[model samples]
Target: MGRWVLVAVAPAELVLIALLAAGVEVPAGVRATLGLLMIAVLLVEAGRWSRGYRRGRRRGLGRRAAATVAAAELVPPPVTTALRWEARVWTGLVRGLGRRPDIPPGAAAFTHHRAMRAVRWTFVGVLVVEVAAVHLLVPAGALRVTLLLVGLYSLVWVVGYVLGAGPVRPHLVTADRVVLRCGLTTRIEVPLAALADARPVRRSRDRTASRQLAGRTLHLVDNGGTSLDLDLRSAVTVPLPRGRSAEVDALRVWVDDAQAMARQVRAAAGIGPGAPAELPPGR
Candidate 1:
């Protein structure tokens, strides 16, 4: 965890270390530019983290609802409730547009379907704007053809998001296995029989490994922080981002109410409670 945290801040750390080493040799202007760039990166990452918190709070209504699990403390209950409403609206859209995917029986779904609505709508806006431009701005030329292709790609992007996110089948927490989906491509399944221990991960924890692994991890999180860590009894086969699979035993996930999840998994798998289940620090 410490290593990943350091990794997340490495860019600025390396730059500052280099600046200190260079001292009088480096131009003052260059030093200032590097400093500003580092600051900007830090600021951007911080904003992203905060936004994820907001998105989380806005995800579900009740405390047990998926969104509130991780974000229960980040925002006011009222605000969080409002955010949940926002997420519900997206789910509504998904249902209205097509048949809602059959969720697993006796399971719960943890999703950012509401948070993803913006992207889905953004793609729609792009498709509309680009198609309008193809006909209105460019009249019968190479540029028009280019614009047409761009418009088609925009349509494709919207279709992809809808097809990927609209399905309710991917995010399921059942008595036996846990399935987490990212878009359409990445899917992770953790079965009870092969399980060992589940631990709560602090939200403040850095996501260096999570970022590096990205879609390959069983991440159902809006924030890229560690909310839960699962230690496998043995290596399990899971799908990676690019139509591939990897055998992994140590799986990190960002989800709501990680403590509750940890408890649930431990209980279901017959693992003793109060045992140290945390992943090795900096691993």
Candidate 2:
């Protein structure tokens, strides 16, 4: 749990207790209305996210690829799990302090969808402005406006969560060459001879805490694009080996074994070394 939430709990509890002492009551109808509102908000947001994901898939996703992406979108952030674990540890620590400590709720990872994060934040800023205006200039009707703002925030918040949970599928295929299909827009082939190296890119929230990270990475100029243009994070790279056999290594072993067979065919036909080999054309 965050420090801010923990600190607020004490005052929030005290405020509730004071309200009870003063005979303040919240109507049951209002509680039911809020519950229904939240349910509606979640369903609408989920629908919108599903629609966008489907459109991406329908344009060209493979069956297995579509399923993989769908599943990622469905799960909540893993940080939420970490926050729950944090709560259990803190509970035990505070138990030894003599005071009866109330336990704090765990934190959950909430993600903003890749494309929607900007729009969501902008909506939040607008809500903040509306809230400020209501409180400062129209205080008499602020209660209703505040409730309306809360409902709108809840709707947008669920949209952000759905985007965070949406599916992501990246392709890595190993054949005679390496083939990578990204999103619906790119198709890449890397000849093994031109491949220079493969290593994992290490990622950490704080750089100093971890020394080593591992994942697949490949380095090759490819038919086009720089090494930086490819998704190297969680990717692998293979560099061409050096020696007298380098050219043959790229043509026969790296590009395709069929190229070697075609070379043999050309030699048998009394063709010179300068002849174009009957190898499959590059895409």
Residue by residue across 179-234, what tens digits does model 2's lDDT show?
A: 43222122345543333223222222222211112223222221121112122112
lDDT of 1 by residue, 105-181 (tens): 68766543553466667878877876887778777755566567767765755554565554443456788887766
Tally clashing residue pairs in candidate 2. 23
- The window of 10 residues in a row where model 1 has the poorest summed lDDT is 208-217
List TM-scores for all candidates, in order. Answer: 0.48, 0.21
* Best model per lDDT: 1
Error of 1 at 183 (Å): 2.9
Which candidate ranks first by TM-score, i.e. highest? Answer: 1
lDDT of each: 0.60, 0.37
After superposition on all CA atoms, how large is the RMSD of candidate 2?
20.6
